[model samples]
Target: MKNRTIDYILRATWQAVSRMYNEEAIKYDASMAIAFALLSIDREGISSTLLGPNMGMEATSLTRTLKKMETKGLILKEKNPNDGRGVIIKLTPLGLEKRELSKAKVKRFNEMIRANVSDEKIRHFIEVTDVINELINNKTIFEK
Candidate 1:
């Protein structure tokens, strides 16, 4: 039987989700990237180096986002005591409030999906995703 490529399906699904988030974020005068960044940070702080990897973001893009967030008083950067060369991203009071709103939006989206999708299907989806990740990480994707 003919079928669509797995990569195409993945990309399409993600694009749809991103568009949906961007639309929702507009209502709060926020963007998906901003909400995602806020979600990635810890209450105390998160290391700049660690943040990029956690969010799968490029250094330049992340830097720009952080700068905007700081400008908006959503976050602050302080010297990391443990690493003088690095900084910690700390959410401000306003940042905390926004983060909570982001959290609720994320929960709402996930709950909507979970309510519609069966548990068994979700489990299979997770299993497939994990296997795909493992294959790529292990460089086994093209193995004969």
Candidate 2:
């Protein structure tokens, strides 16, 4: 009660950041999910399988987002030449424009943070997150 927990701080900070992004996204008629997906897609196109993992999204969520993006004329899904059963996701011209907007917003946010926070603190924050990710990926946090 006297001290805040690590998870509490992480969750609260992320929620605030997420809210900020959502507010910015709304100005472009987008959601954070859509913006993130736009940024994740490659110019040459990416396999659906790879896209989902790269975006840290589940199949169902990614599928829904992709469908919405397709409806909005932001992306196109085409057969992957390398795999008969796979599809490649490519950004449309509009998608590319949206992607740039998303990129700019992210850059501005980071720039603001860097202007306020020392570089060393940012590096330490990244290191801590990397360690957290490694622990999660290695399944060491809950091992028997």
Candidate 3:
């Protein structure tokens, strides 16, 4: 247990995956986060407040990305009729196109992983990750 560190493994795996996505994103002049956000937004529309948490992004970062997407004409932010103070983000036709691209890239990545790894291993990995998240959420780590 001491020799095998979970955090180190998690970081290394995440970095490798990020690098792969970044390299692929370069062809589209986009970042993984932008692609992720594009896919995160719903077809109908999504609340501005929900976007950040859904993407695991901070408010400022989400705002900046949304602005950049808006500038690119990929998304349109309109008033949320139900929620006077909030905004709704919807994908433009261009955004929908880019979202499909992002989705394809993600699917390809996952397919490669599934081809290389066994389903049992993937299931176990997901279970481990869920348990880790649960532990973190409960603040159970390093507790007496």
> Could you give candidate 3's per-residue lDDT for residues 29-140 as a string of tens digits?
7888889999999899899999999999999999898988899899999999998999999999999999999999999999999999999999999999999999999999
Instruction: Show the lowest summed lDDT stretch of 10 residues, model 2.
Output: 1-10
Clashes (N, CA, C under 3 Å) per candidate: 0, 0, 0
Q: Model 3, 62: alpha-carbon shift in Å?
A: 0.5
Across 65-141, the per-residue lDDT of candidate 1 in tens digits comes to 99889988999999999999999999999999999999999999999999999999999999999999999999998
Predicted structure 3: lDDT:
0.92
TM-scores of all candidate predictions against the true structure = 0.94, 0.94, 0.94
TM-score of 2: 0.94
Candidate 1, RMSD to the unseen true structure: 1.6
What lDDT does each candidate get?
0.94, 0.94, 0.92
- lDDT for position 1 in model 3: 70
Off by over 4 Å in 2: none
By TM-score, how accurate is candidate 3? Answer: 0.94
